[model samples]
Structures are given as structure tokens and as C-alpha cells.
Target: MSEVAFRLFAERGFDNTTVEQIAAAAGLSRTTFFRYFGTKEELVLGRVGEFGREIADALAARPAGERPWEALRRAFDVIAEPRPGETGAPMDIIRLLSDACALMTRQWEKTQGWQSMLVPEISRRLGGPGPATDMRAGALVAAAISCLDAATDAWTAGGGVVSLADLTDQAMGVLREPGDVPG
Candidate 1:
């Protein structure tokens, strides 16, 4: 259903596309579509929620002794390293989201949601929360997400001329800077 929505969103502008159209294209009833996705925005950005969980789970699964920054880098690496035949979803979604003001706003909201979910888990992994621990967790998560954002932005701007995984690795490498030491 999402892939169908993605293709429709790409072929027809996001604003021009409708739930009814997406439902029809996917051969699902509008009722079924509603059962799956509450809003068109949710349908479009659904993978983001899954990615958020993936990052959190990846972080949680890392060696307990790993530094917070290093764990985050590894967590992000999970998503940054694409599987086979997975080249186009992000580019298409980025293009679609870039053009739509609503989705862009929702994107920001979604990111904050992801960050909120990460903070406590990060704090836990760093030996539980204090003001300092919470602050570090928040900052690290923000920086990691920013690295991904910058990499994706660059990828989109360059028409995907460079590998996104490499870009992500480069961007994320900044976290290793000595100045990025967490509390």
C-alpha cells in the first residue's frame, strides 16, 4: 500500500494525490486504507516511524560497554547501509516531502517524536539519567539525526551522485570529534 502510495505520490504531486486515489491504485477499499493509515501524511511517512524504532532497537542491541556516541553511530549505520534493491524510496520520499509544506511540518514533528523515544533509552545505556546525562543523550540523538538529514539533503541536491551510505558515514564521523564528548 505504501509503495503504491509512493508511486502515485511521485507520478502525481503529493498535494494533488488523494487517499481515494491511493486506495484505488492499491486495490484496497477506502475503509481498508483507513484501517491501515489514519491520514495521507501517515501513509507517506510511515516508514519513518519504523526507522525510528529500528534506530532505537539498534542502539539498545549494541554492546553495553560501547560509548554513547559510538552506539549511536552504529545505530544510524543500520539504516544508512541499505539492503539490495533499496535505492529509490528515500530519494522519492525526500522529493515528495520537500515539495509539500504539510509533510515537511509533519516531518519535523516525526523527527522530534523519534528523538523523544531515543533520549531515555540513551540515558539508560549511559548509566541512567541526570540533568547531564539527559542533556547528552538529547544532544547526541539530535546530532545523529542532523548528520542523516544533511547527508540526505546533499544526496538529493546532487541527484544522488554520491553514495548516501558514504555521505552518512562522513557526516556521522563528526560525532567522533574530541569536542563531542558527552557527559
Candidate 2:
């Protein structure tokens, strides 16, 4: 159903596409579509709601001794790129989402919604939860997510030629000084 909707969204603008059209194209009744997705947006952003849990799990799975920033980067790897052995995503979805301002905004909004899911794990890595630790963990998670968004923006603009993980690394690296000198 999502695949059919995505194709329709690609062919027609997201604003122009309707749930009825998606249902018809998918060969499913409107009731069936509603049963699966409450709104047209869900067809696109469904996976995003759980992104925090996914990211947290990925971060937690990293080596225990890994630095927080490195673990964050490694964690984003799962979200940053297509899974191994899968064909690369068709540019149509990227184009579809990029062209829609409402969708772009909503997508980022959804990303923000997941930040809390990552904080506890991040706090754990920062040596357990407390005001100071949680404060720092929250900041780091926000920064990491922002960097990931920037990398994704660049990827969409560049036609996704560069690997997203590399782009994310590049994005995150911009915040750091090249040499280890006394600040």
C-alpha cells in the first residue's frame, strides 16, 4: 500500500494526491487504508514514530567503551543509509518529500518526537541519569539529530550520490576542530 502511495505521490504532488487515489491505486478500500493509516502522512512517516527506539537500540548495541559521539555516529548508521543488500531508495520519494514544505516540516517534527527515546541510553553512556547527565545527554542527542538532518538535506540536494553515513559524519565533524589543541 505504501509503495503504491509513494508512486502516486511521486507522479502527483503530495498536496495533490488524496487518500482515495492512494486507496484506488493500491486496490484497497478506503476502509482498509484507514485501518492501516489514519492519514495520508502516515503512509510516508509511519516508520519515523519509532525512530527514537531504533536509534537508542543501535547506540546501546555499540561497544561499551566507545565515546558517546562515536556511538551516536555509529547509531545513526542504521538510519542514515539503506540496509545492506537492499536496493538503494528510488529518488522519487526524496523528490516527493523535498518538494513538499508541509511534509518536510512534519518529518522534522516527527524526528524531534523521538529524541527522548534516545536520551536514557545516552545518559547511561554518560554514566547514569541525573540532572547534569541528562542535561548533557539531551543536548548531545539534539545536536546529533540536527547534524543528521543536515546530512539528509545535503543528500537530497546532491541526488544521494554520497553515502548518507559519510555525509552524516561530515556534518558532525564540522563542529569539531581538526587538531587536538588545548582549547
Candidate 3:
């Protein structure tokens, strides 16, 4: 369903594609499509909940002694790793997102939601909460997401020569620096 929708959107442009058209192209009835994905936005947005759950699980599985930021970085590394047979979907998704503001907004919202869900889990993994725990969690999530966004933007802007991991690390390095470093 998602693959069909992405293809249709790429071919017809987002505004020109309709739910019905996506349904027909995917060989699914309108009711079936609705049952699977509630709205046109969802068709373009894809399975956000599933991906969030996967990231949450990955974070949870990290060793208890791992720093929250480190664990989150590893989780992102896991996410950015290319799958066995997948070719260019990640780059294509980045392009589609760059071309559509609404889709980009939805993607940001999804990332924020996932970060919120992971915070408490990260807190727990780091042992009992302290006075600064919540603040630290929020900051860690924000920094990790900022890294991902910068990485994606840099990769897209560079015509995809630089790896997402490299850009992500560059973003991470900014945060890892001592407080005295000049901007």
C-alpha cells in the first residue's frame, strides 16, 4: 500500500493523487484501504507507529549502563543502516519530504512523538530518575533528532554523495563538544 502510494505520488504529484486512485492502483478496495490507512496523509506518511515501536524496542534493548544519548545514537545508526536488498528508498523518501512541506511537517510530528515515547524508556534504562532526568531526556531527544534532520538535509543538498551517518556524526559532534567551544 505504501509503495503504491509513494509511486503514485511521485508520478502524479501529491495534489493530483487521490485516495481512490491510490486504492485502485494498489488493487485494494476503498474500504480496505481505509481499514489499513485512515487518510491520504497517512498513505504518504507511511507506518509511523510501527517505526516508532521498532525504535523504542531497539532503545530498550540497549545495555542499561549506556548513556541515553549514546543509546539513542545507536538506535539511529540501526535505523540508518541500509537493508539487505533495499536500494534507494531512503534517498527517495528524503526527496519526497523535501518537495512537500505538509509531508515534512507530518514527519517532524512523528519524530517528536517518537522522541516523547522514548524518553521515559531511556530514563528507566539509565536507572532511577534524578532531579535533572526529565530535562536531560528532552535535551537528548532534541539533539538526536536535530542530528538526523541535519544529516538528511546535508545528504540531500550534497546530491547524496556524503553518507547520512557521516552527517549524523557531524551533528552529534557539535553536541559532544565542550561548552567553551565557540559557535
CA lDDT of every candidate: 0.78, 0.76, 0.72
Better of 1 and 3 by TM-score: 1
lDDT of 3 at 148: 82
Sort the predicted structures by TM-score, highest score first. Answer: 2, 1, 3
Worst 10 residues of 3 by lDDT: 82-91
What TM-score against the true fold does each predicted structure earn?
A: 0.82, 0.82, 0.80
lDDT of 1 by residue, 123-158 (tens): 876665652457777887888789888887787778
Cα RMSD of predicted structure 2 = 3.5
Candidate 3 lDDT (Cα, 0 to 1) = 0.72
True lDDT of residue 120, candidate 3: 76
Output the worst ten-in-a-row residue range by lDDT, candidate 1: 82-91
The 10-residue segment of model 2 with minimum total lDDT is 85-94
Best lDDT among the predictions, by candidate number:
1
RMSD of each: 2.8, 3.5, 3.9
Candidate 1: stretches off by over 4 Å: 86-92, 130-133
Tell me the tens digit of each residue's lDDT in model 2 across 1-183. Answer: 877787777678789999999999989999999999999987777656655567878888999887777788899876775765422142344456688887778777888976777777778777856524577778878888989889888998898899777899999887645542111
**In model 2, where do residues sit more than 4 Å from their true spots?**
84-95, 131-133, 177-183
Model 3 Cα lDDT, one tens digit per residue, 63-138: 8776676778777765565555442255456667777777888888877778777777765754536424666666
